[model samples]
Target: MLKTLASYIQEYKVPSFKAMFYVTLEVIMEVLIPYLMSDLVDKGIANGNMNIILKTGLFMILASIFSLIAGALGGKYASIASCGFAKNLRKAEYKQIQDFSFSDIDLFSTGSLITRLTTDVTNIQNTYMAIIRACVRSPLMLIFALFMTFKINSKLAFVFVFAILFLSIVLYFVSTRVHPKFKKMFSKIDCMNSSVQENITGIRVVKSFVREDHEREKFSHTSDEVFSLQRKAEKLLILNSPAMQFSVYVSILLISWFGAHLIVSDSMTTGELLSMFTYTINILMSLMMLSMNIVMLTMSISSAQRIAQVINHKSTLTSPVNGATKIENGTIDFENVYFNYGHADEGYVLENFSVHIDSGSTLGVLGATGSSKSSFVQLIPRLYDVLSGSVKVAGKDVREYDLKTLRDNVAMVLQKNVLFSGTIKENMRWGNENATDEEIMEACRLAQADEFIQKMPDKYDTYIEQGGSNVSGGQRQRLCIARALLKKPKILILDDSTSAVDTKTDALIRNAFMEKIPDTTRIIISQRISSIQDADKILVIDDGKVLALGNHEELLKTCTQYKETYEAQQKGGDFDEQ
Candidate 1:
């Protein structure tokens, strides 16, 4: 996981190295100050030598100034390295998500992905800063202080060494206990984000159903779980502070007590004992910083693994090398096509579904809920690949064509019509980036969207709210259809996209398709029989199998399902068409 994350530090390597280098210089200067102070006290002060006192004090001040400068430079470089590394990491994760197939997206939720891209990346970024700065400074400070202590008095150095050993043991115990709690806490955070996202996205439904209290309770439950886990982790973390204080106080007493005996025996100088005290404080403070960094590492270890999961994942779907780029016609054939949502144990959503449509013909699809109507059309654009057999377009297997080229020629307005927040013209341009105003208006007219758009004060320039919330369902559906129409695709599919529009408007949109773009193969999926009764061919499917396939008149005579649906819709006033 560390290796995977380290790869994103590509251009920030220099900054990282410079941070460590400057920190090393800072530690060196700090060690020199304490060493010089010992001499200033033992010879300059004890002997009452004014010259020696002045010279040694001057050297100590110089070391102090250099340490300040080095510390400042170290902080600057660490900031640059960490923030740049985060940028590269965030870009990598986002780019990888773009490459994922629909199946890959299914394995993760929108909320989880958002958390990984944002929260998880932030955790890793903060940890990176701590690692480059404190991780280098603390260890180097401890080592240099210990070296100076041993040089001044080896017997007193043992006191610092024993204290270091005791603190390490305590830190190990705290980290081990705390790490699992922190790991679990972050996972709970993912769940909380998922709940929040789902609630906000479906806030209207919750309001309509009077379920705001239920959503609030649900969110509170996840939030409480996160709080509980973090509190438990922090309970263990609090041990570090008391442990550090105990070590510092005990080491001081041991050094002071043993040094008094050495001084009485004329074995150690007063100045050396005072310097030993300073080195002890330096070593203990370094340990405190090290412990703090360890706490950060414990938290970030979990976050880093979460981030690695996203970065290391390879999309199962990829375009073929030197793939075919041209689609000859709108002709589509399902030849013994067997498919599931990449879950073989769940049975196929489309089971050996074989059908052939001639170029530029209109086909109607009728099915009950769970009939996989949308799944059938999705294959035409290669949104999902078949498990067995092949889905062919333009007399070639879909897998043979370049993914972008195949999808470009096939436009699909799915059952859930979606529009992004933008001006009416910008949203339409998603269908054709280079489309002119004349071209866009023509497509909207065909989709029966031009009438409503012109009624708005801004017309083409009207701003759409997020998720197209500013428009009614019918308008949203028509706008999506218009966007698809702007593609000028060879094959256009409406997967129950017009369900919200009245029958009269639906008929007008269908009539426009037939009249203005007769050569573009149109496949319409609808539950109401009236919407598809005029098609050249109608397929009635259930449970991933074709129950009936024929023209409207032929199916009325032969297929019980089609006849019953048509009669039921007619009796219920589903349409006024004769």
Candidate 2:
């Protein structure tokens, strides 16, 4: 994890190194000032020499000013390096997510990814700043102060060694107890974020069902879990302050008692005894800073691991070394295809699936909820690769084609229709960025979306809220269909995308597809038989296998499932009339 994170510090290395250098210089200057004061008191003040005292005091003042300047410069550079590292890490993770296949996305939850990118990255960034500044200065200051104290008087210096040992032991024990709780706290944060996001995005549903109280309870439960875990960790960490203070006070007392005896024996001067006291405080305070750095490092270790997991993960699907770049036609062939989401030990979602669609033909797919209708079309655009056999588009295996070229040729409007926050014209342009204004209007007209769009105040320029929340379900479906039509793909697959519109609008959309875009292969996956009854061919699938395949009239005569479904809808309509 350390190596992976360090790799992101590419351009910041210069500033980071400069920060460490300034910290080193600051520590050296600070350690020298107390040693100089000891000299001025002993040799100059004791002998009544004004010249010695004045010269030494001037040097001390100069050293103090330099230390202040170095410290300020170090802080500035540390902030730059750490924030730059965080920006690079977020960019790398987001770019990796863009390349992931559907199977890869399924392995991680949206909430978990959000936490890794946001809270976890911020934790690591703060830790990096602390490490560059405090971690560098603490050890250097401790070593320099220890050397100066031993030079003044070795006996008082030994007292510091014992005090440091005690503080070290306490720091280790407290950190060990706190580390696991911090790890658990971050996971609880993920849960809390997930709860908040779900409630906000689905607020309309919660209000419509009068379940506002239930959502609030759920959010409160997750929030309390995070708060409780954090409190437990903090309770352990709070012991560090009292332990450090006790060590500092005990060391000061020991130095004062021992130094007075030395002064009486004529072995140590009064000025040397005063310097011993100053060095004692410096050494112990440096240890306190080191202890705090260790605590922060411990907490950030969990966050570092989480960020590395995203940066190091390799996408399961990758473009072939020399993949095909051009598509020949709209033809699709699924030959002996078998696929599962991941576990091969479990049965495949599609087994022995075979189909051949000629260019410019219309094929309707009918299936129950879990019959894998969506999965079947997903393979064509290579959203998920087959576990065995091959799925071919335009006479080449999907895996053999360049991912961009294959997906560009085959447009899919998935089960969930999505729209970004933009004007109606802006959303339509996503399918074809270079599409002219006239081209945009023509595509909307073909999708049966122009009529409603014309009624809006802004017409084609009407602004759409995020997720197209400002539009009705049927209107959103039409707009999405129009967006896909602007792509002018060779193969267009609609996975129950028209389910929201009335029968008349649905019929009009189908007629537009048949009449306007005669040369594009159209695959319509729908529950309504009326939507696809006049298609060139229809497929009836059940339990991951094809139950029947023929034109609608031929299926009505031979396929029991098709005949029963059509009759059930007819009976429901007649009952409504009565």
Candidate 3:
């Protein structure tokens, strides 16, 4: 984990080392000031000589200023290094996520990945800042001060050994007890974030269902779990302060008592005892700071591991090194395919799914809710690799083509149509960034979206609200279809994308596809039998197996399920209603 995290510190390494350098300089000056005070008291004050006193006092003043400057520089460098390192880490994690396949995304989940990127990364950033400055300075000050105290009076210094031993035991107890709680606390935090994200994104649904109170209760439960865990961890960590202060005071009191006796016996001078007190305080205070930093490091350790997990994870799918870049046609072939999500024990979402879609032909897919109709089309663009067989596009295994090349040639309008917040023209360009205004209007015309767009106040320039919330569901679906059409892909898969629009509009869009883009391989997945009755071929699948493969009239005679669905829909007369 450490190795993985440290790699993100690339360009910030110089600032990290500079922080250490300044901290070292600061510690050296801090240690020297006490020694200078000893000389001023011993040689100058004792002899009542102003010259020696002035010289030592001036040297101490210069050392104090230098130490302050070093400390400021150390703080500046630590901030730069830590913040830069965090930027690198976030950038790397985001890049890795962009390359992830659908199966890879399912592994971590959206909410969990968001928590790792934000809360976890922030924790590690603060810990890194402390490590570069306090972590470096504390041990240096502790060792240097301990050495000076021993040089002054070795017998009195043994008091510190006892005090150090005491503090070490306290640190051990606090660290061991607090670490486990901190791990649990972070888990609770992730849960809380997930709850909050879900509530905010789906607030409209919550209100529609009158479930605000339920959401509040759910969020409160997660928040209370986090608060309780944090309190417990802090309760243990709070023990460190009193233990540290107790050691500091007891050690100082012992030094003062023993040193006063040594001075009376003429074994040690008053000046040396004064310096010993100063060095003792330095040693104990630095240890206190070190203990606090150690606790923070312990807390951030789990965060670091979480971050490393994302940055180091390899996506399950990647294109071959020298993969094909050009697609010959829109033909799709699924050869003895078996696929699942996350793990195999979950059972195959689509098993032994085989199909051969001819180029420039229309194929309609029909299935019930869990028949994996969407999963079958998703394989064409290499969204998820099959477990045991190959998905081929344009006569080559999807994996054998460059990911961008394959996806660009195969446009998929998912069951849940999505439109980002932007101007209508800008969003339309998502399918083709360089698409001209005339070209965009043409695509919209084919998708039957131009009429409503022209009626809008701003027409092509109108801004789309998030998720296209400002527009009706039918309008959003039409806009998405227009955008997909702009891709001008060899293969176009509309996965129940027209479910929101009226049957008349749906028929117009299908007719437009047949007329305008005749050579494109069109795969339409729809529930409305009227939508697929005219297709060149219709496939009826159930339980991951094909029930029938023929045109509409052929399927109505051969497939009982398809015939029943069509007849039921015709009798009900409102399957097209949104």
Off by over 4 Å in 3: 575-578
TM-score of 1: 0.97
Query: Clash number for model 3?
Result: 0
- Model 1, span 1-578: residue lDDT tens: 98999999999999999999999999999988878888999999999999999999999999999999999999999999999999998999999999888888888777778888898888888889999899998999999999999898898799988899999999999999888998888788888989998888888999999999999999999999999999899888999999999999999999999999999999899989888999889999999999999999998898899889989998877888989999899998999989999777898999989999888999999999999999999888888889889988889999999889988999999768789999999999999999999999999999899999999999999999999999999999999999999999999999999998999999999999999999999999999877898998998989998888899999999998888888887787764344
Q: How far off is residue 337 in model 2, in Å? A: 2.0
Model 2: how far is 227 from its true place, Å? 2.5
Model 2 pairs whose backbones collide: none
lDDT, candidate 1, equals: 0.91
Task: Residues 369-438, candidate 3: write the lDDT tens digits.
Answer: 9898988888888888888889988778898998899999998887578899999999999999999999
Candidate 2 residue lDDT tens string, 1-578:
89999999999998899899999999999998988989899989999899999999999999999999999999999999999999999998898889988777778667878999998899889999988999999999998899888887877789989988998899999889899999999888888887887888888999999999999898889889989999998888888899999998888888778888888999899888888888888888899889988999999999999899888898888889888999989999999999999987878899999998989999999999999999899899989989898998888889999888888888888657899999999999999999999999999999999999999999989999999999999899999999999999999999999888888888999999999999999999999898888989998889888889999889999999999999997777522124
Segments of candidate 2 deviating more than 4 angstroms: 343-346, 574-578
Worst 10 residues of 1 by lDDT: 569-578
Candidates, ranked, lDDT? 1, 3, 2
State each model's CA lDDT, in order.
0.91, 0.90, 0.91
